[model samples]
Target: MSLSKGRISLIMNRNIQKIFLLGLLVSSTAVFSQIQEERLILNKKREPEVKKIEKKKTSVETIKNYPPEEKSAVPVEYEITNVPAVSDFKTSTIQGEDLSPKFDSELQKNYFRLGYGNYGKFLADGNISGNLQNQMEVGANVHYISTEGLKKEYPWSSKQSSAALGGFLTSYGESGKFNLNAEYNLIDYNYYGIYALQPAADVDLSQKTNQFTVDGYYDFYTNNILNDARVKSSFLGDKFDAKESNVSAMLNLSKHAVQLPANGITMNADLGLGIETLNSEFAILNKNYSNYFNADIAPKVTFFSGNSYVMLGSSFSFLNSKNKNLLTTDEVKSNKAYWFPKAEILYAATEEFKFYAGVDGGLKMNSYASMLQENPYLVSDQVIKPTETKYNIYFGLKGDLNQNLKFDVNAGFGKVKNILLYEANGLFDNNATLNRSAYNFANTFSAVYDNGNVSTITGNLQYYPLANLTLEAELNFASYRLENLEKAYNRPMVKGTLGAKYTMLDKKLHLGFKGFLMSEKPTNSFQIVETPNPNVSNSTIYQNVENRNDSVAGHADFNLSAEYKVHKNFSIFALGNNLMTQKYETFKGYKVLGPQILGGVKISF
Candidate 1:
């Protein structure tokens, strides 16, 4: 369901892939003691009316920011549009369950957390906002987290921090509503992953990243169907000197009635531009950065009858890019166009079961901000390509098996023009004149793309076996056929999540457990071999034995959390993650902080 938090963005291909992620969100309803998590951003297309912008906490300290109970204070849409985006996957230590309390509607709506754990882990997340006048409000939030390296084995340090913070303001007039926000994200991290089987110098394992973003949106609530329009722009970069800027504007229009077979019609379009830079490593084949302009539109018509709905739509995109020739200094320019179907059908054949099927596809633009957030320790000179789904055809059955249990299962197949994968950077010759990137040495990952066909089987289950008890589960299995790569590097064949909660003492004391499970993943390994150099003296020549096939053992990490409400506005929680002490890796070689205990207080005022 969660696919491990860091694994989220990488698998975000539309249609079947989208189904792979959406089922997990729905299964969350089955497992319940009462989940009080307030968060968003990992999936943006689903929230169209709200125009979700993927609020990244700017601070890595939070595995999940804005404790859920507090979300009521600010319109969830307002909260999402202003937050820049979530921090990168930083080999973090706290993938624990949310033990935050679920309060009554009368309680205050602001929430805060302060936690500390093993491996020198520290985190603090809080925010304050107030209504200034009639419909004007101002708010500011703070997020900070720091953790030390895993000291158990030999290789390198995984020390890192998601140190970002910012503020926001919103106002509504007689005509429309608007919100504005700005944030700065500062992250310090390491490239600690090197196979113990093949060790290298510690090298300077540290890396620093600085990024800034100013984002806002204005919504027009008027009489016509042409009602909502929004805008977003951001600048993302890192210590590697990699830089990228993105700007976009979008509009949504919808209307129902005044039609024959089709009762409703809706359409939306987005136009954007990106300027990017990523220096090339000659050995890896120089890939000059591409700056591009793009535009897309999606329009759909809906037909509703009884308890069923059918919709038909299509997606169209246009792109113009200027790229330096690969493996050469010459520049190349190109223009491209893409289109896909967006049709869906739902039929209510019985009160307890429904049949649903769809064929959906779209384009996924990649940027530095998005790529790094997906995997922070990426090679600076890596190429970023936008993935376009040709199509995904799926069908499923979903409904209540009983009042206490519900389930949805689906299977699908699709082809994508550019599906991205995370592979270990190729090791280069030691005698080369090239000044290697910090992410080289096989310690960091690089983004690679290939054309591929994918088939996925996914399911979600939610059940309430007893009063005050909730349990949730989601699972996905996928198989891929690629045109160029050996395997879908770091992509798991099986992924899932499990969660359960129990409340006692009149709901003042809560006990909960949550777990993330990922199957073994294939990877690339490297070793250095020496050969006799006839041109040199007696010294032998060293060569990189690169891109060897390998794999990371599959493992599961479970966390437990307990919380007690001390007063109406205060509470204490004790959370332990990696309880199984699996010592697992969130990425290829970077082992996450595990078997940690964090005790903290929560406040609302």
Candidate 2:
């Protein structure tokens, strides 16, 4: 159950008053107790002495006391032994998730932007425009996230487990009629033990993930300066605890342009290769699962003009394996080919309206057999064929009314044929589920068939009534049909937000309030399967067996911030978020915390 905003506010106010009264009472009691203790001490009677005669006799006897002689002190020297050398060899266990280093060398660095440029008056004599600029960034971030849920013995846990240490440096020069640019990014990310939940009891999996990517590109243009060439490349590597390293790379070349006659155009061609060296333990699993090594080369091209465009592409892939236990595992390699083609058109009817439509068709090869061999399942067949073909078409419209209002609407329909699907056997079986499947899975391997059609529509609207107020709304609806299934499912989601901001004290202080509402139905097939198995076998029946009553969720966030500048480079500020103390749920059963406040100082130069 959730409380309304008004009720929560009232309770908070009452609690605040009670806290103040309790604090006052505690302070008064402490002061009264101290005063009583002091009074009791002052009331005690003091003793009087009667020793005049004794004092006179004692003084006479003390007059005969003599003084002692002074003596010189001697210093002693102590021998210091050489400290024994500490052993450099030490042993420590690398256990637990937090064992990784928290800091890196590149984290301590500053970035600067440099440039050189000139501008001159042109009048009617000549036209010229050019500039040179260089920019770079160097920084690292360490983030930690943990989550635990009910209905589970061992909490499902996942760690990002990464330390990305690298940066990008780029330079650019631009001139009229011609432009040139070149940039390179050198990045390395080391990932370890990033896992997802599986049905296996008391059994967890781990992997070693690392990747180094270097990207550089250049472009040149002349005459109308309508087009340019571009190139890109990337390399990736992964190592699982049970499997050795698998590395892959892709390189692509493309031509880019803006408004090629009627519209924009881009054409690209790519080549790729991959290699995997499996460890002994994983090799056994691969042999039983009919795993294979694979590589591919692809070429693609696209053309765009006016309100329409077209694209064509294809790829050739090769697979090889050496396993006798499974079919297609005895070095019985095969070559596969695929093709994709697409076309689209868009037109603007007026200043306030536009329309777009497009269709795409493609074939995709399956790589799951090689990708998921580490599981405890046996494979009856290793070489899964490519998807037959797929196509999609979409249309949309966007426009603006007046200066402060805008709206957009779009709809798309798609169909897929002969799509590749995974079939799992029993729980804990290597062939039961895809090793890489995260958060979405059903029982063990069965005869998996995939063919589906989907349609979706989305609409969004934004309006601003005043300079500081805005309102926005968006809605989406989608329906999906599996060719092998009898029934189609529909999902509808909606979100809306309204916000306003006001500035005061010469615009140095600002206050803002925003309210947002979101609602969605669990229309996903995976989510629906949580219900009891239906009696009907041929027809797909979706029954609403459970109602979490949390689909309708909303919250209001209020921000009160003030900034006071004390000097040219220093300022003090206070910021508070979620000041309304509203409580709500984000997902079906996930409760969100409320009401946080923060204040700090900022220095800038």
Candidate 3:
């Protein structure tokens, strides 16, 4: 109805000129999309807005090239002439170990100890080793001591015991060294001097007596000339049914003959052979004893300079003695031949100083295992003889008085023929007209062969003030002149010994001390008949055989030891033995068991 407003204002002026031409084509396409205004030239000043990139793909293939070959270059050379000089050069010291599964390793010195004391004493010791190859070495050892003796107010019955066990093997080679040793021993004794006159005389004397031993040793050395070879063996037994066995062998041969230059004057020679045999069957309470066979030949000559050495020797012996009786057809035989003249002289005024002189004599083999090692109460028909040592003159002085000192001094003189003395049996005052012979019980002992002259003086010393401290001393003096067993009975004319050692904390504490001294000797006595039986035969013979003298009293002994090292295989030890003596007798009537104190622990793996 209103179409006539100038025809709607001319259609709004053609839609306002088509909305102003679409707003000028969207403001000129947002001002050229806001990013392409980077163009400068002619006064070039508007440069901002440049991030438009789009080009076409481009690819190109390559070409290859190869060519090369060349060689030439060499230089390396080293050469030097011969060289060798060194008589001897040595440097060795490398011993370290600790492969940790620790057991006190310092190569584990191996040890074991046990102790107990106070009358019934017991002690044990042990050592063990290993290294089975690479030169081989092996070892084992054990020793035991026992006592339950004396002291019941001491009327009799003094006991003793000893035990040992051992094994050893050593082998090294590149030419030489070998050592082997074996041992077993046990000894027990009692009989209590017939109970010092039968204190209630019932007799069962504990361990009447016993001894068993087995020993063996073999040695071989080489430096040429078969330098050494030795074999020693012993088998012993006793417990009534006596038995003794011994074997010995020795051979040594050497030569240098003559060689002189540098330290000049050298001549040496040696040859020696020895053989010994002994077998015995003795039963003391039941007699049957004596047997021996011996042989020897020794020759030596030596002369050396660069500080003297001279030795000339000769010894040849062949001896055989046997006593065959078997109760009845008594027979005693002897065959002997001997000659000896030996000498030794050594001098070295320096190199620690030394001087020595010697003259020797021999033929001193007597058996029943050498009188049971010098009187184990000798009786059982003893009369095997060979003592003759017509000469033994010795002089010595050994030195090293500075590096903590060491010294030795000796002087000696000897002349002996039979020289065996000990006699008591019943002192033979006609033991009931010589009809009493079951040892005649003056506590048994008989063996007398005299003819003697001996004099000796000796001294020994070692001292180290500090460097762990140590000191030792030994002195001996002797004099015996017997021509028919007038005296020199028990035989001991002063002997002394002393030793000490000390180490402090850093060494884990250790201290040791020892001492020994002996003096009085002569002994022989008799008196036995009992009852009114005494006056019956004018029984007042204090000591017959024209009154033999008597003596016996000399004793001194000491021992002290301490060790403490908590661990490194653990250690703790203490021993105070015979600490100034509670008992001592070097055997006249035998009494030994002492001040013993004990404590123990020592283990090393």
Candidate 4:
């Protein structure tokens, strides 16, 4: 029997379910045994009941009084208890009366005009009050990213060094009934060098990249109508690289209401236009790869009700380019349209439980050839086709049982048609051949977790036994099949994390400890050239090689932080991460930066 990737993933999900059930059973059994023992002990110490008293003397005394009472039965009797009379809890007071007249002047000048108004009135009044507020932030980081293991795998040694400087400034203002806001940010990244061995010689290469963005927004409202507009743009450039730019603008209009409905519904729509351009020297290698411009306009509509919501969105983009490369030499021009239709339904079953399900799908124009042509290093002489399509369907449930317990489970399936892959040939050939290469075409596969044929199950639990303390644990399991030579290979990856935190010094100090465990067996596929049949059609063969380094590894991290308030406007603090200096990899073959120690003071008003 042959098992498909989807089937394999389903089987894995079932196994995880079984494991969860077994764990639940064990926990329930322990709790049940304890309850039974407690009940038995309580029953062993039962108490006896007592009986009570005779009325023979009272009957003799009542005989004479009954006859006299019958003769005077006409007299009415009334009884009153010595209890206090009920009083009204509600108080009535005259309106428009000043309760605190002594502070009226101060309230009108400082509190009423600028601070103590209702939220909406205060905000609107401030907009017309002509006031400006500015904020600025500046910080620097010294980062080091090394690929030591990656270097060892290749023919040369490599290391990543980064010294970054970044900052932002923002300002806001109000004029009459209008408000304006603006901000700017800048960041730079410089790479020292990359050590690698090319066929000609060993070389060291370096590059630098800088990015800048600016944004602005204006909002104004009058009577029942509101208007908002915004503009944003970003530019990125790198040494020995092409520059890219993105600019966009949007405007919105809506109506205001004096009082909103208890069961409210809102309908909002947006129309926007944007342009993106990319230019680079790398485009010279492939005529099909050149500077190109894309213009797009999109409209989105969203509807929200009590428990149901839907969104419909679509975009049409036009591509324009002049290619000097042979593949794109035909004056590439194309128009593409995309659309998304999605809806969600939610039910509140109880105070502690809720259920939800959603389905979202979209149509996208896929360019297989354009993607391949852009990456010259992938393979030689590859022809990519444009216009592929994809669709996705999903259903899930999410909710919480109590404040300390919560869960979410979702399953989805997606498919891509006319996808692209690569095939390669050795030594002098620069082009890719489908027969010589293991994968050379745009291939389509069902969408699973992490772009592989995998099913993932994740869950978390939290317990808080004391105030200012918390303990949390998380677990994830993934089962998938790696395809090679038209066969399915089963692989599983499992990861877990457990952590606890304690707060002290009136929550000014915090301490935490965390541990992580991960295990996985990765299947590697490669193509090898047969020595004797170098010219034969089947000279290259694809095989799945099992990497034996699948082992469970774990490490613990300890962190401590303390904050001391010097005054209302100023404070000092000490923070430490990875205080234990434990040796571990944040990921496979990637060693973590051991420990960092820093202290700083913050001032706020």
Highest TM-score scorer = 1
User: If the candidates were sorted by their TM-score against the true structure, best first, what order would they fall in?
Assistant: 1, 4, 2, 3
Specify the poorest-scoring 10-residue window by lDDT in model 4. Answer: 88-97
Tell me model 4's lDDT, rounded to 2 decimals: 0.31
Candidate 3 residue spans exceeding 4 A from truth? 1-149, 152-196, 200-351, 354-395, 413-453, 463-466, 471-479, 483-487, 493-498, 506-510, 515-527, 531-558, 563-574, 578-584, 598-605
Report the candidate with higher lDDT, 2 versus 3: 3
Model 2: worst 10 consecutive residues (lDDT sum):
18-27
Local accuracy of candidate 3 as per-residue lDDT tens digits, 191-241? 455422444323344432333333333222232466556666667665555
Give me the runs in candidate 4 sitting further than 4 Å from their true place.
1-163, 167-207, 215-232, 248-332, 361-389, 400-407, 416-502, 512-605
Put down candidate 4 lDDT per residue, 180-249, tens digits, no spaces: 2222222121111111112211332233334454555544422123345566555554443434454556
**Better model by TM-score: candidate 1 vs candidate 4:** 1
Q: Tens digits of per-residue lDDT for model 1 on 221-296?
A: 4413554566667776656565677776777664443235444432222222222232222123353476767787
Report lDDT (Cα) of residue 335, candidate 1: 82
Query: After superposition, which runs of candidate 2 have C-alpha atoms over 4 Å from their true positions?
Result: 1-166, 173-214, 217-328, 331-334, 363-389, 418-426, 429-449, 462-473, 485-605
TM-score, prediction 3: 0.28
TM-score of 4: 0.47
lDDT of 2 by residue, 203-242 (tens): 2323333333333333222212222333323233334322
In candidate 1, position 551 carries an lDDT of: 84
